[model samples]
Target: MRTCRTRAAGTAVALLLAASALTACGDDGNGAGDGAPPELEIAVGGAADQVTVPDDNPIKEALEEQVGATITSVRTPENLAAMLAAGDAPDFFRLNRTQLDLYASQGLLLDLTPYRDRLQEYIDFVGEDVFELGVIDGKPQAVVRKPAPASYVTYWIRADWLATLGLALPTTVEDFEQVLQAFTTGDPDGNGSADTYGLTGSSTAFNPFAPLWGSFGTAGPGRFYVEDGAVVNGYTDPDTPAAVEYVQRLVGSGVVDPDSFSIDFNEARDRAFQGRAGVMAAGWDAMKKQEFVDAAAAAQPGADWQQLPVMSGPAGDGYITLDPYGASFFAVPASVGEDEAKVDALIDLLNYVSTDEGNRLVSFGVEGTHYTADGDTLAALPALDEDGGYFFVYQLTGRDEETYLEVKFPDEKPFIDVAAAQPLTLVYDSLVVPPEGYTASDAERYATEQLVQFLTGAKSLADYDAFVDELTGQFRYAELIDAGAAQLDELGLTD
Candidate 1:
């Protein structure tokens, strides 16, 4: 989004004229006017490169009309922390869940409970769970815009290749392994060379091998929860030994490329696009993107990929790893005027952006100019030489299931339909108990580092045992169990 400092040019001009008049009176004085508009400076940050200001939704004008204030934007991620540290944060900005906790703990954020009524419409639109993500220590600190379910990862494979090789689609972990072996050795790509890999994945924080690990019924990397009234670390669990052994088998059997550990998510996409990798675990949203799916299709015609459900484990158990609970929210810093009127105006702006109309405008852009909407369907505006031009800004507010279904996978309606029909799994229900002195970012970082080491063979299988021991000892699993017991006492799972 665009960031502009909101100072009244008209007021500045008047001040300069007043200064000139004072100079003629032989009074060397500076001139200022009380009638000048109150400029509200707000800092916003996220995935958007350019912020679009609609004629009717001009924030500055809207703020002035509603609350007699002008708004300006300052863009900076670093500034959010720096300003909060000095107790002078921005009027409003985006914050990840972890950062939200840090700021909330320091009492640097405003208690948004008083203004929650103004955001009722927004709260209703995003659902209660998403809305609650902005609450900290029993206080609402921010408003979430775009929130999507976290457990949307799906395994994709070359369907035609599977058919040619006379292999059935893999549903269980054992089946997955058998298929991977065939893809690696049988020249499924028909190149007659055994240079192909069975599976590939990005090493990014989200999708890496955690889901694969989760397939073994262990909470893979970064997942922490109170089980039986105790906090159990997923990575260090006994089940992880089997998971790691599986990874080692994939690596040794040539089903997984040896260099898989070195590749990032995007690079892994390249491997898939180039026909070097035959299988991948990616988000449903990602598979819909033209760059990953369409490009791969064009690179190898008739090589349509199909999404597979999360693999079932030996016990017939399967679960997808959950991402952070909610879409990020925008927090207004205390530096902004604390009056109810100013806060109300800010809420109005947030409310507008979170609505269907506002979200479509921001995401799709200028109706016919960037995209066209036919009833419920939204299509991209004519491309500017193949560049979509910041269309994703609209999606930032919040993504409805229909929008994702339309934009990401128009052809794969059956898969989308199946996923929709499945029961909603409350993966983060237990994790949301809010651990004392714990932050989600810490868990994310720890998982990313430790998991990479394990995947790369940088850490030995025995090291896996040591890692688990160290984690449990440090985090104290028994204490976590006790905490879970106290917090989730009603669930009856801890008793």
Candidate 2:
């Protein structure tokens, strides 16, 4: 009888395998024996330090269960040229918009046109124009995630400081200058010393002074374009001279830090937190972060930090910088030909994570085990020995407006609702064509090196025409425009 039971169990396994094979023709839902699903490897970019992976959210398990394939992940740094050139490249990886042309020219990424129709849901979620950023030389090369509002730079101010000084928030450039002066001079902290500076900001290389330059009339460098037939480049335009002069004046008057060009993003944030800086420009998401808000509150109790709308420019225009959709995106390697099973499996895995249920799993972790949900409120679960470190794993997939609201800022419902109601607009109506003959890495390196000199008065602002001529000569903007012209023409913007 014991021997019979062992033989019977083996027979049952064989029968189940046969059944799965036959049902694979239809929606068996078990995702077994459909086809030889290829293993996929993906590389991503962004806050890698903050990402946490749970055992349950393992890429291999998720992909295998959802689509009968295995997937692995590698966090690629922003500097990925060496990796891309190597023979052992991952199956899929993320690349910046500026770098797409270089990779596509080298035949590194697969043409996604064949799969365009299937990705309609994704296209719709991230607006059409924002989606267009991923297209290179008329081919859709990548997927877009988190299409941020363009030209929208918000300044957060200490509201309690204004109230204490018996002053109102500044609306115009002149008024803003006055406010800065008051913050620096008027013992705003009641410390009886003139230790406070009017304003402090991150170094220009990371977050350029484009917004401040825009307020004076000239769009900052890298900010102008022909959107719907209007020619605009904020930095080279006429108002730029005045803006440059304004910055010079601010530095000369000692109201702004002369060493502002040396500070990094984190250091600038620390300045604000330490109650030394009065104003700064940041994204809506940054303002919503607990660290930033808490920092200001801790430094000055009852300090009401208010988000300032983008300031009006001399041209009477208000603009905000649009955040790039998915600082980067995953792309299939050219080696992965049109393998239908592998592609299907890949799509299924992506679809699973994009869904509400899967999103909650990675974002909130196992609700009863890692967290408890009370109606709409979610509370943390007791610490688990297997729990990963400080970072949350879900952020790796990318954040949507809905997911962001659920996890980060549940208390700021009114602000969140308003943001949902009034979505911010993109800044440059026309996309600045990435320069030709240069790799994305090259552009980033150039921008990183050149922005500080340009902003800090180290580069001469004399002879505005000459400066423009020199920049055009060095970067070959004309060639870039020519390369991008055909695409711009297709969009019906370039007549």
Candidate 3:
């Protein structure tokens, strides 16, 4: 067994995989006696950590072993700035690309250029696109975690209900409303009760009503959109009101469950699983889980849920907003750069995970002990999930995409194909802005909230013209989209 001395207190401990199994482990077969520092503690953002971190679990021990150094974290999100001011910062941190500008201004981050050459091995492994995520203003500011899993939202409907009622998946806005009518009044579940609704929507997560915005050629629920070569808020776009009218029709006609308007996302999903609704919005990743599959199966003996094609309407091409940002990325504290040894240790640990072997270990744990595989299909041994190794990614940095796809969506080919086939589009993420003042978030808030009111008859669509005037006048809404378009132009994302 190889032993690494703890970096913090200069004590030795063995955390390597069992010597009997680790034939290709990266350690040099010597402890920290070679003058290598002990472990370097790091910070991972909630975004990246949403999926994982080593966290002193068995995975951390294994990672430390592979990199020939100890690694540790103190879970520093709540007090990171204070920690940095106190010289107690983690060696690394994770953040969105926008945050790079702020940290650079505050001198809290290490400019990653000096380390870029050193990161060539990783860049080569994952490609420049993943590496570019770390770059802002033409310099690398952080290590961006890469995404490769087939995760996207689906407009899932009760296939058994559609089959039972001889209904086809709705392809246009009008068709959808008709189907919702049937779903509400047609007794599709055949349970001999009028206890069902045609459609359900949620107040959270990738915005469940986002597709309605898409049907009108608005990429998302945000205020800013491009129309006739000019940036305009959704309230100004004629189709925006049309989309609202469709929702109001559903609610006014008694096709939508009133409870869905305020229920949590999970509860809304439960409504679909319990066979109480005909159509719903779901993410592909969450839908593929065995638990969700079982939920649908229990609704009926062989009930199936399938994704509807991206529906179309009068204004734009069919499209759905795929959140441009996924939870991932990490940055080294400026303090870490002062110590050459710590920087190299950080690089070594990251470079290790960028490779296939390291990514698998980070995600699945020990081959024989944490999981077992046959013919390329791997299953986590009971202990792996029990010990929490099944959830850690060590990623906020480099990730192996192939491993992620195989592990996260082994049977998602059809689901992915449906997403790729979606039509007419609006992508509100193009207009990224902070929430507080003069931003897309504020605009989207007004738009979505008004939509809810209009559906409930608290506000009438007849007054939509006044709503448009309010948003355009109060928010400088046109200027916002113009600025966003300029940003896209600078990035060559807009013509």
Candidate 4:
């Protein structure tokens, strides 16, 4: 219930749908069933690499046959409102949580409440916690997909260095600090040059300093956090100062390169494997990614890296990183509001996409042509490994990471295991933009700026009170919080 806003190519996801279209929705939002046009228009957002679909798209042909819907894909439309105004509306459009809420609030979206029974199976398949995220005003208006794992993000450290220094892995913030000290001072790289630091950080991709904020119990950025029965923003949380101080100390001790504050992710990652730092303070993905591994090998041969154990603080144990809905979600145009048959048909199509057969079809394409399934392993065919990388584009929900990881990263069993054991995802509904004069963005920006100040030693935790006062006094952040809290309470989600 705050304003908003995943990792790897597959796991960390928040299907960011930039397709912005609104129309009168059909009563059912499913569309006419049997007589429905096999052809439909779908707006998909992808990497800049995603251009027009090839003339002979396997997904298009297969989905048409499977769901009796002819689907036309529109690549990267600029504005949803403009599309609607032009009278060229895609029957089913994909939108992120924010757009979904915004359009729904405007009564521009079809209510899927009637089809709850029809969608219950897929909803159950996806799990209640996540599906609940899609509900607006107690009615399901958008489909929320299962998130990919945050496995790409995990504290990775120099195992060789730890072994050389005779140090055990850190299990708590205190131990982590001590390890950083050793990495900073013990010449763990063994070059005897003392050129190495302990950890590294940057402003990109959650940064290596994420554990600092996580330990303070912030639920990612802009989340409506329930603490002591009150909604509080993590930015101004009392403990944020401690988290800030911890990072300041790390930077001050020279364990973290002060330059890290300004560099982007690639530099931080590049610095990690370049032997400039011990305890790389990045994700395990760096260890698994061939290019990164190659770089690490060239810089420091015989170096072994392993993930750091989850570090604990007074509030919780772990790091904070963005998470998202992996599967693209389709929102119905208001134009179909009265067309119950069409809406029902759309629901049927979505239901098929949720099934095991549908998943296999969309994920791997036609079995023999795209990939060969050897029991649980899916070996990609030459074509799919090349041009067909985007086959899963057809999926509207239930993008199972287990299936992908099992097939692609079969050896990294720990990734799926760790994902299963982790707590439920942390996301909030900042979808509905507040009044024209107020923006959650300003407040968030101020908070991020303050955090940066805290880390760079420009500000201290002791100044937190003045910081909070400024945020409330000058920015009027209270309005944002109250609106979110009211919405959360109305939805019975404030707990």
Local accuracy of candidate 4 as per-residue lDDT tens digits, 89-167: 6767777766777788887776778777888767766777666777887888877666665535566788888899899
Q: Whole-model lDDT for model 4 versus the true structure? A: 0.66
For every candidate in turn, the CA RMSD to the true structure comes to 9.1, 7.9, 9.4, 13.2
Q: Residue 306's C-alpha lDDT in candidate 3?
A: 82
CA lDDT of each candidate? 0.62, 0.59, 0.66, 0.66
> Which residue runs does candidate 3 get wrong by more than 4 Å?
1-36, 47-58, 73-76, 136-138, 148-151, 223-239, 298-302, 315-317, 368-391, 398-403, 407-413, 420-447, 455-457, 476-482
Better of 2 and 3 by TM-score: 3
Sorted by TM-score, highest first, which candidate order results?
Answer: 4, 3, 2, 1
Off-target runs (Cα >4 Å) in candidate 4 are: 1-36, 46-53, 113-121, 127-132, 137-139, 147-152, 220-222, 227-230, 280-287, 316-329, 336-345, 368-388, 415-436
lDDT of 1 by residue, 1-495 (tens): 123323566678889999887655431111112433344445556544256533244333433464455655555456667877674565677776657767778878888787788787678778776677677768887666645554666777888889989999988889989998998889988878887888887655434454566577666644554445554556545676787777777776778866666678878877876788788877655776556667777777787688777777753556665544444566767544344445655666566656776655544445565556789877654541133343343233465656745553456666666444432333333323445764435544555677667765677777776665554455453344445445444333234
Error of 3 at 342 (Å): 1.1
- What is the overall TM-score of model 4 with all chains considered together? 0.80
Find the 10 residues in a row with the least total lDDT in model 3: 25-34
Model 3 Cα lDDT, one tens digit per residue, 369-466? 77888866777577765654334536545455555545545577567667655653334342244422566567668866876787677898898788
Instruction: List TM-scores for all candidates, in order.
Output: 0.74, 0.75, 0.78, 0.80
- Error (Å) of candidate 3 at residue 341 is 1.2
Q: Model 2: C-alpha RMSD to truth?
A: 7.9
State how far residue 86 of model 4 sits from its true place (Å). Answer: 2.5
